[model samples]
Target: MQQHRCGGGALAFCALTVAGVMAVTAGCSGGSGAGDASGRGERLRAEAAGAGGSAETLRRAADVLAAAGSAEMRTSMETSAGGTRVTIRGRGAYDFRRQLGRVTVVLPKDAAGEEGHRPITELLAPGALYMKNRGAGVPDEKWVRVDTTALEDGNLVTGGVTDPMAAAELLRSARDVTYVGETELAGVTVHHYRGTAHLGRAAGGASARSRGALAAAAKGFSADAVPFDAYLDEDGRLRKVRHRFSFASDGPAVEVVSTMLLYGFGVPVAVRLPAGGDIYTGLIQQGRTGEGGR
Candidate 1:
């Protein structure tokens, strides 16, 4: 079994917002024309035949991700509700082949220049999950056993870039790769492609059924086809992907989207936690700090 890369703080944050959007769109479109949901399969076939890049370009991008052994990344997250603003900064490393990942985050504070001073670490290793507080004396650790079989069930969603291989697998599984059009992303021109995967309605339906009584009562589970859209650079590297998921009871809706950035081909970064009196661990889950620990 090939290990996937774990996405650390920054990647995870981007994944939740950007990646979530991509997933939703991909599943919704299902390789059909932008608005016409019925002709997805045929539309994808036509698009693949007219793809702008050769097969070699796609292969090279796959190779880059496969060869990526490690990398260092930084991510910032901000959420707003009412009038208050909450922000966080995170840095971490990802081991692509080992399906392991680790990251340290600095909690937010109102004071300027206080962003990188406090640290919390999260690690996903084989057979166990670990979290530590690096700013205090003698770091603390938490662990969970690794279970490989769960990967097959599709229930296991790795936290960070440790699962890039899985992204590669999903790409490989995509069919009807077509050259849809071009768009500007972060000032760079990118070619867009759409693809479809059958993902048998039975499996999709079964998953919906497993959602239990709440889903059954509220939505009335139903099986449906999924779609995906991918954006690639001139070098054929996949920079973004969107997937679409269905909800049984509600009107046809879009679910999750995913975007990938600053992918360092197989190089890892070194990061150390900060040392200070106000630092703490599990800040995200623990909420606002009361001070004292150093």
Candidate 2:
């Protein structure tokens, strides 16, 4: 990791972005467009095709990732609500060939507000998603495992930038794409691209799926297109990304800004699956019941 470069700033950017938009300035528009959703999608696609530069670069970045066998990344995120803020950061080594890796999250004090500081970690092993919690609140259990055969539907970069593969899919399917400009990141020359994407649609893509952490950074998904920005290194890999969108559950509108960084392409990854002694599966079950405590 000589360059040792990527999305920490992006993650910090995400944290600051979330704080900046803690209060949504506009109303919630969470549907498949107001009218003629499909038709509007087509129009947007046409515009994206005509609007080259940044949009074309996104496709190239995806292509570069598609051929790489593996990579390592550092992911970080911050969320603030009701005057309280939580910061979550992680280090991951992904086996792109296997589409699996382990993400060890560095949870700061009050990272989950009421959840307290927990040294939580996730393992994206084959076919199953597992979590180990060593927090003050967890009761007698250190592991929560999900016997998952298929990935869930959600934003690509949700819950931090654990899965940049989903981000590749987003770049491929984005619309209204534009070139933001060029800048240097981590002392490396990089290009900046911006575009709008529909989270629901991105979820339905053939390659889009949830991974290890169900603790998504995003609160909810909207039918409205969310704004996203990408920073590509000279090698065409994603150095950083920023996604800004709105989610409304039942109360006021809230904005979610997600940023991710990717580097250390083709790095070796080693993951250890926990044993039966670690199994205490209440957390996943609670997540299914919508009372998740991660």
Candidate 3:
């Protein structure tokens, strides 16, 4: 492993990108799209306002998203380690029904203030993650496929950005949740809720395609309890959510704060998986900090 590497295998693409430029971002929407039910929506809001409904409301976040069909999202992942902080941001859209999406992630500029790092395009799908513009030894035109289940963080932190749908699915494990009143986000009214989620428990109730990844995350993170804050719209759709995760590193543990903002409900999201030949199959080289070639 390289000194600047955050982890091993395909998972290292995240940190390697960071090492290259000292770098460097999903889910849910509401309306009468796919899963929207006025009756169910009323009950959902009523129940959420009732006693002990916070957790239950959160657990159904994925369902709310699925109902919305698709959404446009912006993500920010900030990792703090050894007094150094890096924030990676991304923007894209997700299709809840197909469990697919694409994000263009931009890394931070190096300390030397060189040109910005090339943005990485990531295709998120069931059980797999395909990344292009992944530096190191890979060619610009080739993509790298990573088995989400094989990643220690279950492609959660490993991919630099959490899968949008996966992030919503993780809410299925919400526990000790409390409604934190209403707030305005992006000019829309939303209800805020806070709680801790257990990845192992989440995997049990997650969508079949997400189970393996969440299960892997359960065993990968330094702890099982992930503190989070979620915001829901009038129809019980998830508008925003933030999760805090800690992972062990060579030195002190790195604290990652991931935030996802969803908007443009019922948006069209089309993501096509790359062909096998377009994927690079050779050993991937690790990048060093302060190095060029992002």
Candidate 4:
């Protein structure tokens, strides 16, 4: 039987793991340029107004992301617990057309061991989901029949597990886009944008509802709503995304801040599974664990 459990503390660990990988592979910088930098506060206020004006801007961003091809990004995560701070990094690549993607994360040596590691690599080709693991390396070559029906049911947001490119597309569709002035990020000037992300129809069908309900039952399955603050370059490509969330039920709030760096667009990279490594194909099947499910 496929037993899935909440990643719980794993969530924070996952975030940190991604952060660590990103820090090493892709240097984490703040901000981008200074072309339009006269009125900072005014621009931020205006941008916030535009985003608050309507949810359509959020939708458009998601659409643009969906239709786009492949993307490579680096991510960083920081979490605090018991007055201790933990960090991690990750690198990811996605192919929208094929609905296939891979994310590789490197964790801090002292943070946690292999048990805390999360590695996702899959190829949605032919008639099934082809998956392998670099961490475990168990199921060398395994195929789970493509459940398009299930994919359709989980909606776009939750379905991202099987199809991450779709998730990226949904995120891009967020509406009310506006420039929130300029800020210095890692020695570069960046334009910030604040907006709401609308869960498009593609992510709201019956299939999605059912799966979502189950996920919610497992760990207070709440719709992921994030007030995005994105830093972009002059070319309009994203440089950093900063946001926070409190998964706590009734305790001190825990904050999760993740920054993603975009590298190559429409470029494809071959995903290779680790040879002679034990594989854990059940990671994705697990639900949120520990307090996160409370």
Query: What C-alpha lDDT do the candidate models reach, one value each?
Result: 0.37, 0.50, 0.76, 0.41
RMSD of every prediction: 12.7, 12.5, 4.4, 8.0
TM-score of each: 0.44, 0.65, 0.86, 0.54
**Clashes within 3 Å, all models in order:** 50, 2, 2, 53
Pick the TM-score winner.
Answer: 3
Off by over 4 Å in 1: 1-61, 68-100, 103-139, 151-162, 197-226, 245-258, 264-266, 269-294
Q: Determine which window of 10 residues in candidate 2 has minimal summed lDDT.
A: 1-10
| Per-residue lDDT of model 4, residues 1-294, tens digit only | 132221432231132221121132335433223334456434434444663532333334333443556567665555554344555555667654554556554445545433555453444331223344422324545422223323312212111222343333334445555656667555555556666443443235213312342233124213345445665543344445654332442433444455556555666756543333333434333223122211
CA deviation > 4 Å runs, candidate 2: 1-53, 112-116, 125-128, 134-142, 146-162, 208-220, 273-278, 283-294
Model 3, 32-88: lDDT tens digits are 332344565566567778887888889988998998899888888877665666677
lDDT string, candidate 1, 63-96, tens digits: 4444545544443433232233344444565565
Ranking by lDDT: 3, 2, 4, 1
Give candidate 1's whole-model lDDT: 0.37
Rank candidates, TM-score, best first.
Answer: 3, 2, 4, 1
Q: Clash pairs of candidate 3?
A: 25-88, 35-67
Write down the worst ten-residue block by lDDT for model 3: 17-26
